[model samples]
Target: MMYHLLPSPYESQEINHLTLAYFVISSLDFLNSLHLLTHKEAVSDWVLSFHLHPTTIPDPNNGQFYGFHGSRTSMFPPDQTGALLHNNSHLASTYSALAILKIVGYDLSNIDSELMLSSMRNLQQSDGSFIPIHTGGEKDLRFVYCAAAICFMLNNWSGMDKEKAKDYILHCQSYDGGFGLVPGAESQDLHVTFIEMMYHLLPSPYESQEINHLTLAYFVISSLDFLNSLHLLTHKEAVSDWVLSFHLHPTTIPDPNNGQFYGFHGSRTSMFPPDQTGALLHNNSHLASTYSALAILKIVGYDLSNIDSELMLSSMRNLQQSDGSFIPIHTGGEKDLRFVYCAAAICFMLNNWSGMDKEKAKDYILHCQSYDGGFGLVPGAESQGGATYCAIASLRLMGFIEDNLLSTCASSSLIDVPLLLDWIVQRQGTDGGIQGRPNKSSDTCYAFWIGAVLKILGGYDFVDSKALHGFLLACQYKYGGFSKFPGEFPDLYHTYYAFTASSMLEESGFNSLCPELGITQVAAKGL
Candidate 1:
């Protein structure tokens, strides 16, 4: 009843889609079941008559490239060249697509430097924040986070105007000691502040007591989530105690009075915060909450020896479906790479896999792998890096691919890692940057998902580090943010992940990305 109202199957425009593919495959990987691949052509060919290898246009004489899709249509169009150009080098898809290829065992040797740089340039905002693309959307913490991450990944700061961008984020802070989506906005969310303060506040050498008091005591802790990544904190102990308070209502350990922690409280915890009750508990469990909560726990250093691990895992257990993917919560909403990643993250954190059925999960992911050889957010869906990362990580976590997903089949041994690696390589555009999907352009954020997955798959030796890192640096803006694709504006999501990816790649840009607040190495880089 609930899922029917959520976003339906993948729309051609919905590059980040949800379905049975990633979730089921993720579950299978969780349970150590690679045999599921024998069941289907889940990986044959897609988008028909179209070929691989990204195409690009130039921005000017200084070596700027603009990446565009020959088409965005899911179905074949009679006019092959008429397809809308995918100038939007979004942070989410950039990484998601890369991760997908990594899952399929593709090394990223085909990224295009100029195309990637152009998307990075396009997304940068003069203010320290980034936009997903020049296409336009409201600016705030989400985009800024992505932009910061993207820049960090590519070793590029050309996409942003650091001084102005930093000023813009500072302006968004409210009287309540938190940040808002936009300046002077009534909806003050701690999530926004947590992300913003880490990037924009806390002067270098990071000794700002005001920033610590403001962030440490005030950030929302319901469901135990504070931010997407850690390493930004000035005082680790303060954050630990702050996170510990959220469990007050539960029975000592992270258990259920209802089992899962309450979803909202202390401000950003609620969907409607400014006028809400004593922090109205959303009788819901969300991937955002789950991921944030567990991440907070990891940063805070809570020993699970005292916790009720089974009860919490059981809470997520209820969301699993027969098809093998997980719902957002008991609300039974959309299933995509986002939630799938959250679920996998939670299990990874707890070091447990009981809640999900693994073999079936792997089958779902295998089905989602597009004919182009990249992994998608779901079955029969376009491959995305974020979803691909969720799929690969979950599989790796569950110890799938011991013999590899395609090796066991008697009829077809064609689904080996090298083939998928080749597909991932091809997604790279003219600038040596990896794009999200076939016919899609490159962005700065995928450096982590795609890069990390390649490393995890034991094929790190194949990457062309010189071209990839140079492309990352080329995409950076003057401001502290990174853009979606080159020639586009910057956004937070990309920036954060870009930082993460860059760190993982061991690029020289790591220190400059986040010298303030002391997050030298972001999780994305670690992954």
Candidate 2:
């Protein structure tokens, strides 16, 4: 769904236009209505526009990282001599752009496979994990998967050092039979290690304090999928059983919405009312954990045949506020776009719309939009890429973009499309990475947050693919991982988003991503 005018919340995501495109185009494909997409050729051209060709340097070795930029904001002024500035290519964007093109049936005969492959080759580390950008980030199983997918898609294995990558994946296997983000790189802090060990020894996360079980569950499942190691999980049933235990029944719930819900733990005997609620304000069910719970179930191939869907839906409905914002739990805490996005995602996953009042939710999302055409956590709050993403995604899930595509409604009737687009384009700095807000340094996560929004806006082609690639490279590290910014330590969160950002920017060598669901389209095929 699209509005002719860009909504304010989408302003911060200008860099991720390609990702937005993936979500739009892929969704159309899923509905078997791809033929309804307007300007198919133009859309394909826009995706290709992100491609970054190497400059004409004689024997260009260092500049071999040609790929695509994340957005046009990365464009820089040329030197007085008028030579084009170099923009390093990114593996993730390369793959994503190509996937978008392929989905639209764009002829790939003229694609520069050699340049793309050469760039990818330069991203591989000794241990087999591929860095997302030339500058580097985290080297983990995620990038390894991206590299492999890229090579496989290009029908070229030369892009990656496959054997080393395999070894890296193997090394990541932990004593508990789970994989961490990095190989031989589990937390080394003695205190952290001891705590983790204690955590594992405990029968459930509920018994422990300060643990976000949702993050743990998603990481475990996602890591396995990235490595294609789900088959290695011999105790699937046991894992599933453990996850299921987090479910809270109406009898156990303290709120008016007496529905079966999922939580981070079952230790809380009663739901906290809005004032005394610990998480946000009132402690109750957690939206993040609910998503993780459902996702884990799907990943485990459970088909959700045994879950109480009605009760779950009712629980979700209870989290909704009159303002259309959602609280993570019944106890009432922070009301922001994050939970709104979560609620929308949960409803989407459930194939139900009753969890929220769409009109009221839409109005509330519009309220959070800021003057800069970006979305903030609340009215008058500063615009942020993450918040912008949540707002736009919620709108998309509510059919804003689709409605624009299908109807002749005036831009004024929806969101401010023109200004929103302009604001998004302005987020890219000369460094080629996207900034979350004005005057802030670019970070890795915005690549997905802003990029996906831009893709949705159908203005991705306007970005400077090369410059964005170069920026991501600058953030990449020598050890095979990406960081939030240049020269920072790589973490799983930034690294994963970097991978997706790179994918959306240009073709690095992977299948198309399902932006809404945050998984590979191929992986989602069965669903």
Candidate 3:
């Protein structure tokens, strides 16, 4: 069952659909699947068209960029009811655009930094939070990550208010110390942890000095790894304990009698009742479980050596769809490219390729590459940043770094490193931080995906240390948080990503933070 290019979240649902596009493009870029793209020029031009210039700051309380259109059409200017439908510019799209640009090898030579800064200045909320786009949509860690990514990429952060943003990041911290998407939100999750880690890792730790995003981040990440059914994380002394206590659910229960695992307990469980088991899954396969599990393991510092690497790969490979891509749920009914990315990442993280059928997945991605030279989520789908990231990252993890990938990547020689450095380099934004897409505004979390991707790619050299450092500083919200676009609210997902980006930048400069993710000299876990 193919996903429709949706319109609105409810009726005219568009964000969900378009966001998929972003993920698709970003994944493609990550997989090093640009060869499948039809016309890189047209793709680049299309992505940039979303760049809304002359943005007016909506509020001065926090430095933020105003929202722009999400797709080709505009959703601003409320109807008679004074209800805003949606904006075309989404932080997700912004990040996606930049990611796409890099994938296509556009140094963003045509991007206007100042113009984006102006737009960024307008999207601020007094509490140091930001709306998704220009009055675009809900503000959350996802957007915050996008904002921070933009600033990191641009090599400049002169867009958002710092104090308030920092405070916001601080405010969202739970008693457990892990951060959530919104303040007072329930238990932490992987996406949120990723974002919070990005922000908490920010420099000069403003009001957020005591917040320790990494400490809590470990918890959230640990949990995510547990849920993915990845044994390494489930065995972690602390992580294993946490899951044993808080996450078990009937649906997610390892066995009907065991009830050992929760159904993505950390991820916004509010949406579904705590008791609910299986989610409304698209695929018969549960790739989401695979991804969250892998991400969590990465966060929890799971030693791959202790567990059966084959289990994770086997789980993923067992769920492969006829298309050679993975399916998130187990039905194997609806197969999207996301599973491919998740499966690819799982294989990459495990340092094993047994689970992934690269040839088929690559064929699907290539088939989807439009005449514009950008790959889409599924064959014939529009190109997007998130998806591009998935694709490129998958390829890097697959050890398929080619000249085209190297040119798009930074520090070409680093490709030989365990992590696919070529794909990571392309994730960088013209600014310094990495955005998911081009022409769209920049965001925070891309730093994690793009930055981490770069680290894995071995192109940490391509990043400009001072410039990226400067960008991270600017994206810091006054409330002690980080935003994807400048001048926006901070969220957990983006915060973690931003920090990861900074860590890499600093590491590239020879200043090691937390052992640059997958680099352990020669340890199997490091691989």
Against the reference, the lDDT scores of all candidates come to 0.50, 0.66, 0.52
How well is each residue in 232-269 modelled by candidate 3, as lDDT tens digits?
Answer: 33345675344322222334423322211122233323
lDDT of 1 at 45: 23
Better of 1 and 2 by TM-score: 2
Worst 10 residues of 3 by lDDT: 255-264
**Native RMSD of candidate 3 (Å):** 26.6
lDDT of 3 at 92: 65
Sort the candidates on TM-score, descending order: 2, 1, 3
Instruction: Rank the models by lDDT, top first.
Output: 2, 3, 1
Candidate 1 lDDT by residue in tens digits, 260-300? 43331232343332223333244444555555544545445
TM per candidate: 0.49, 0.55, 0.43
Scanning candidate 1 in windows of ten residues, the lowest lDDT window is: 43-52
TM value for model 2 = 0.55
lDDT of 2 by residue, 74-183 (tens): 54444565444645456666767777888889877678777677667778875467777777776677778867876777788877777777766765654346777763
- Flag the better candidate by lDDT, 2 or 3: 2
